[model samples]
Target: MLMMFWQLTIDANDPARLARFWGQVLGYQPAPPESDTTWWAHYRGRLGGRDAFDDRIFDPDGRKPPLWFQEVPESKAGKNRLHLDLYPTARDDSLPYDRRVEIVDAKVAELVELGANVRRRERGDSYYFVVMHDPEGNEFCVS
Candidate 1:
């Protein structure tokens, strides 16, 4: 695939709800409408009903690619062929193993409050991570 300026696209049953959850998790903001700064309102107005828009969110600091959530008819099935890994402590290599575990666990708790459910905790020879499912059951990891 062509790579420049690409955004990650997510399929969701309820695109707006999923987008809200991810926006909070990633500290992202919704893309504003061209004619209005009121976010969802303009989209809703244009569509004249619900299912207003395909949700888009961008990293506030402009470091990461934007996320675009599209409405899909089917539910998730089987394991994800690809997933996201979140580093709560910003992937610090100098940190102790136990310290990294603590940081990851703390971040997991925060995520749980935001609608993520932990599947399991995993420990490897050199790393620790938590497998989690989003509110809509998409799998991702915290480390």
Candidate 2:
């Protein structure tokens, strides 16, 4: 049997810019083309301008899935159905709730300075997370 690796593709108004922003947020970097033909050309017949890439980023530590941002002219209109939850403390059970909260807050502040906005914070029995919108208005959480 064979396994196929997958990449999370994101639609973006400014693909390269969004990729850079996410790179800063996740400590990821631009990923090189995986193959000599890293593009798909089928759309060229119907959508001539479509390219295989807008931008792509990958975790240097190889711990997270690669992200590929594709350019789209349409602006985001509704809330995203899928989103990411970032665990700043690496999801360590030993970290106290307060400590995790503090770390999450710090990360939120940093992201804000880099062009993200907080939507709100949520509390649970033993959890705390801040829902935020990325520079391109994609929703995600930090905890």
Write down the TM-score of every candidate: 0.79, 0.79
Tens-digit lDDT track for model 1 on 11-124?
Answer: 889888888889999888775333333433433465555332347776765557768888889999989888889989789989998899999999999999999999999999
**Listing every candidate in turn, what is its Cα RMSD in Å to the true structure after a full C-alpha superposition?**
5.1, 5.2
Clashing pairs in 1: none
What TM-score number comes out for model 2?
Answer: 0.79
lDDT of 2 by residue, 6-32 (tens): 779999989888988998988876743
Clashing pairs in 2: none
Clashes of each: 0, 0
